[model samples]
Target: MSEMEVLVEVRGTLGRLTLNRPRALNSLTAEMVRVLDRTLSRWERDPEIACVLVDGAGERGLCAGGDIRAIYDAALVGDPAPKHFWRDEYRLNTRIKRCTKPFVALMDGIVMGGGVGVSAHGSVRVVTERTRIAMPEVGIGFVPDVGGTYLLSRAPGELGTHAALTAGQLDAGDAIRCGLADHFVLSDALGTLVEDLGSASADDVDTLVRRYAQEPPPSVLDTERGWIDECYGADDVAEIVRRLQAAGVESARKAAETISAKSPTAVKVTLRALRNARGLSSLEDCLEQEYRTSCALLSSPDLVEGIRAQVVDKDRDPQWKPALLDEVGPDIVEKFFAPGDDELGLSTVRECDD
Candidate 1:
């Protein structure tokens, strides 16, 4: 067997998958996504594999996200490769979402962007105190993908809208409260928990998770839910921005400022994606919608410019094409959600009984 960038092993009936690139904080590469998809498909049909455990290597835990550096490089040269990246990555994401066996994700450290895509939709999403979760794609001139629209839309009240626009980070408690995570456990206990799962059956794993899962501590954001609802309740991105600015609450004002720094076009598209996702019936539908938006976004000016300013140029100041939110008209935003070739569509994964 060839050594893999992504390591896979079977312990009893439990299949464990680890993202092995810790140096980059286990940032997901295209190759890794392909390997993961293949490994998962194999396990999906394997009678010996009764459950799955997905986690990150080293101390970081899980993954940070898809390799944006690769995407940025492709865009710089006008390569169409980024589309393939989103295509395969989104397919893998859907596979995880629709997996038949119970899937457990151990999110211990930085879980952001692509990380959220893989773990947040699992059957069991475990968050530890050290977990720092976010969807900070706007800062890089990209809208959130990987079923982010679904998760963000489903978040409590208007919190999803706020998080989408600002790329806000959510702590462990906020993750649980936002429904991004199902359980909270201490970071130190993850090793022992994994060991326990190796010897335990599916029922045993469920029992252990139920017994050991801890309630998340109170979150500062929980207290401000009412305010978030008020500011983000607007029907459109423009209205939401205006409401946040006019609210005059310290948190709302700060959120508006953070959002203002992101690519206006990206923010507008993200808002629309989340809104459209609200009507989606399944996670696959949401991922497909996001795939269309992402494929279209690759050709947009803001994505490249945003990547330049934030990642390549390292100037921390992107001269976003429209700069101002008002400059991104509805017509421009709508183009992102437009249909593309069938190649961008998500493929069906085999469903299993858990």
Candidate 2:
């Protein structure tokens, strides 16, 4: 067959997976998602596998997210690939969440978008000092997917809302502080942690993790929580922007400017998605909603322009349609949630009970 996108190995009681697209920062493709979902299912049933560990092959990062250029291309031609890609990719996200085997993800360097889906739901989520993570889809005329809304909905106060609107990266300390990571392991010590975990039983995994986890530095997000909560608490994007502008703090102003730069439609829909996610009972519920929006947004004007400006042309300027947030009313936002004939095709996963 073709070469493997992900390297898999089974040794002793440990099953290890290394994302192999180093040049691409392990960005997920449809094939990679298929492999991961299928492999994890088998490993979960394997008696020899006590636990599983996943790490990126290269030093750059675990995974930067999905291949947006590919998505743009698919959207351009009206190809059906994006739907199948997202449909299975989302199920894999739920698979990780519901895995019976103890799954540990070593999140080093940049992790965002689809990368978060792969790493965030594991039983043991580990982040290192080099980790830089965000759900930055809005900047590219897309709302966050792969259960991003669920995470934002549950973030303390409006911190998740702030993250969604700003698409800002979080440092390792901020990640742990924000409930993204379970433990902080120094990057250098990761090799040793892997060795220890190779022989670790499910019961011993926690002890080994604790022994290896180093205390992270103080978190800036903790200090800024008051501002984030106060400014982003509003469900309306205009109200949030007004609050941030009124604050007059340099940080708040910067955040407002950042939000202003993104697609107005994206911002409005993301706010509504976050609001809806709060009431969802499980991650799967969020994924189902995201599936509908993902397909719907692909047909919008911003997806093509955002990808061209950011990735293809390197222009760094996307002329968002409905240029102002006020132009994106409840009617426009509602369109994103309603899907066409191709629904997400996911069976009931019972993701919340996990």
Candidate 3:
């Protein structure tokens, strides 16, 4: 990858942004986030740029996620770099959600965490068979951020809950069904789609997209909705687990085991964030809530330990401070939602229409 982590250009009316770090799966760093934010801001105001398209450089993925290794390094010594990165990253998410022009995201590969933030909120989200989307933050002792809770809260039935707890990957079918993506084009056709998009007028982008779009395979979540809705509907995580374990479906039982293995605090807090997001009016509100929780995670021991075990050491055995779900009390969860000294202030800065 070049020093320029994000490559920016204009092809006709389409403003193209390519994430340039194939080696790291184009995981977002603070600098990369800032560049995206700046470029999007500039393109939003440019009369010549009628549309914007964002994609990844490599065939590997759009983005793996935010730089966890950087976050882990920052958290080791109480550095505020992670918090700062998230603040700008969430702001960029809000911008994408409210973009005036047709913002297209080619979510053709791995789309998770920060990847979803940049793509899912766009006016046009394109997925391919190669797309593998997830928000596997619980595995790293983190709650979903970048307005993820907002999107997940609105997913059909309790599919969002199932995805959150299990850190499961979502294929193109599941992604479109869960409302994370809008269109499905085959991987082989994506190059032609992009070529057409580059020369097409902004008004014709939709037509061009439809020309290439095809029905995705059946959603796995759709088939399991009956059991997922019933088991994940419970307010309490423990009860949710109990319901999952007793559901008799092998998948549900496996989900229960998966949730049990994740950081207890993250799972509990994530559930709360998702539920709270359901009551919120806009994506900005959810972003604000996420910022709080993300900052709180910075202080929690599990975030560091989880990243160390999963990313640094590759042991995948995170020793959560409060090892069991029962040990994560109300106070612990409440702390995540409490107002901080320095807030992301998405809602406070500008109101977003619901």
| Best-matching candidate per lDDT | 3
lDDT value for candidate 3? Answer: 0.91
lDDT of 3 by residue, 206-309 (tens): 88899999988889889999999999999899999999999999999999999999999999999999999999999998998999999999999999999999
RMSD of each: 2.4, 2.0, 1.9
lDDT of 2 by residue, 1-354 (tens): 134789988867889988889898999988988888888988988988999888898889999999899998999899978988998899898889888888999999999999998998898999988999899999999999998998878877887888889998988888787777889989999998888888889888878898988888777877888888999888899999999999968899999999999999999999999999999998888988999999899899998899999999998989889899988988999999986787764546454222
After superposing candidate 3 on the true structure, give the runs of residues whose Cα lies further than 4 Å from its correct spot: 1-3, 351-354
User: What is the TM-score (0 to 1) of candidate 2?
Assistant: 0.97
Q: Supply candidate 3's per-residue lDDT for 129.
A: 90
Each prediction's total of clashing residue pairs, residues at least 3 apart in sequence or on different chains, is 1, 0, 0
Model 1: which residue pairs collide? 56-62
The TM-score of candidate 3 is 0.97
Of candidates 3 and 1, the better by TM-score:
3
Per TM-score, the best of the predicted structures is 3
